[model samples]
Target chain A: MALATLKNVRFAGMATCVPRRILSNINDCPPSLRSERERLVRNIGIETRRICQEWQCLSDLAYDAANRLIDQLGWKKEDIDGLIVVTQSPDYLIPSTAIILQDRLGLEHTTIAYDVNLGCSGYPFGLHLLGSLIATGSVRKGLLVVGDKSATIKDPLFSDAGTVTALEFRENSNPWFFDLNSDGSGFKAIMLPVGGHRNPVKFFHLIPSEDEHGILHLPTDLILDGTAVLSFSTQRVPPAVEKTLAYANKKIDEIDYFLFHQANKMINETIRKKLRLPEERVPSTLKEFGNTSGASIPVTITARLREKLTEGSKQLLLGGFGIGLSWGTAIIKVEEACLPELIEA
Target chain B: MEEFIEKFQEAVDFQDPVEVTENTVLLDLPEWDSLAALGVIVMFDIEYGKTITGDHLLKSKTIKDLFELTVA
Candidate 1:
């Protein structure tokens, strides 16, 4: 007798938030500063950036995206049985962002709401988590919100954005084959030096310094060893993708589209080359928007889906990797979903 | 002396006067938190190579105690 095989899961609806405020790569800084960081920004594959206003928070961006998704699908907030927000940025340091989003969306008290602290790889991980909960009959419908306000870093490398995806449980759906990996050793590759229990903020006084590049340094700022991160991504991501495809009993050629975390233009291109994916099949948003951390992959998917890029695509190999030194990939089929466009009000 | 106090006040975003008379409870200030503790620790560590932990913070109650800890 043959073993029972689960059917493939499908994406239903998607929405993304890109802040109205645009910060151009050259205009944000003076001409003198531009010449120095121009090559760096270009090498990273960022063009224009988006950021939330002074009063807006990560939850606000997420709420907007989720609301858009609900409006487009014509589904009530009560229809969502589970809500998971994958974010490192929260309105408050204590209460989880997911709970805040739940309240903002007017979800019922019975809805499961929680926040998962992740960075770039959050989207795929969030999907896997949602799929598992729904597949087990725990929840019929789920909302996965991946958002980040890397703008708090005050660095040009990060942008503020969010993406919300709606997942519905079908009677018989294909099991979303997921591959998750993490390496705590590389945690320091991307981190904020202050603002955590590991190093309390009260003990330090701020001092300003200028490095050789004249970049200002402060005690409570985000620091990224760019070279180190790039090297790690280029070396680890392709192999991880290959491993995930093998686990799914699929081949690189079998994947209709490859959705990778929009870390940077070069990194994404490098991974695509290593995977031997056709340039046209790889979806990217890093050129227009800088790295939005957890929101990267979903926002790209939402944008592409809105443009009708994958209307009848059969298979998608999605992967996200960065921060936490974490990586996750999954294969799924796209359904005739009502993907929403950003409505300016 | 006043310059150092001003730097400390600006760093922590505390509006308290820049007077270091020695009785001010550093933790009692409204701006005190784990993040602020880290900011102060790194500031003093970079300046004086003195590392202060949460346990060390619990032992010291006043600004003068912190100064003494660092200078000692």
Candidate 2:
């Protein structure tokens, strides 16, 4: 039997959440004690960092963003029939973060709520999953929440942030097409070394220290092979974009804008150069916020919309890739569901 | 060596002088961070084929200790 065909879905609203704690350049630290790693932060183009206060969790960020989107769109909690929260950081590993969000938001128990453990490629993949569900008549209104706290990794390269995109299922409309893929073999490219099933927490505690370069060092902490990740991103990301465009029977020039995951300044710059996209078409927030994992893309979109860069645009090419060694892309036509201005936070 | 230290200090946004003495306390300097640690590690590994970890630096409180470890 042939597989069932899925219909098109539209994104109606967007919102983002960032912690109040801002680590800016103005913060004082002695120069003679500076480390090489500290220098890398300045060189990498990050200006400020955000961290959730001690009492907050990943769900809090997701809920804040979701509530803001709901408020901006004048959407009732009952209107949302489905919710998908894509995050790698959870308050507890046992119960999914979505269930907690659903209860907190006063969503109906019947609401299809679940969590997808994903990073980097999460925004596009979550969009694809929700779009498929809406198209198949599984639910009418769906909310895709993407966020993560790199604090768990103890890596300053990541910031605490979340984003919510409300998607409305529209009939007879040519919704965007998505191309998704994953290769688990390269999962080690970027990962946290502790706090998992394989490497449970033990008696020994590891803290940050300073190396010869005067940089604070945290060995036995989050270890990322920067070169490996850079090579993977530069190699896999562009092809994913090109293949998706080809599948949609569209050319690079036909794409109005490209919203990619804000992995870093270097990766984004490399991809932009490789794709030969106009500087105006690509949006990035790594310089100010660092990498917010899954929240990067929607946050970028919201930022661009606020800047008036997305006004009057129809075709937008969205791509997100990272972490799972996973990546994907999609193309959507802007409509009323696409709100230009909402929550700026 | 002094020029390298100067560039390193500038790269890490340290306000101190470029002339780093062997006994300078790295932890007392303001430019230390995870990124700076990685940069120093890469620099030492590339220039002198030395690999130092956070634990090693934690044991040594001064620049003289680091130089000794690197040269040894």
Best prediction by lDDT: 1
Candidate 1 residues A29-75, lDDT tens each? 75665654565565567877788888887778778778878887888
Give DockQ for candidates 1 onward, in order: 0.01, 0.08
Q: Tell me model 1's lDDT, rounded to 2 decimals.
A: 0.73
Q: For each candidate, what TM-score against the reference?
A: 0.77, 0.77
How high is the lDDT of residue A170 in model 1?
83
How do the residues B15-68 of candidate 1 rate in per-residue lDDT, one tens digit apiece? 333444467787667655543454454445445555455567668788777667
Task: Tell me the docking grade of candidate 1.
Answer: incorrect
Candidate 2 has an lDDT of: 0.72
Docking class of 2: incorrect
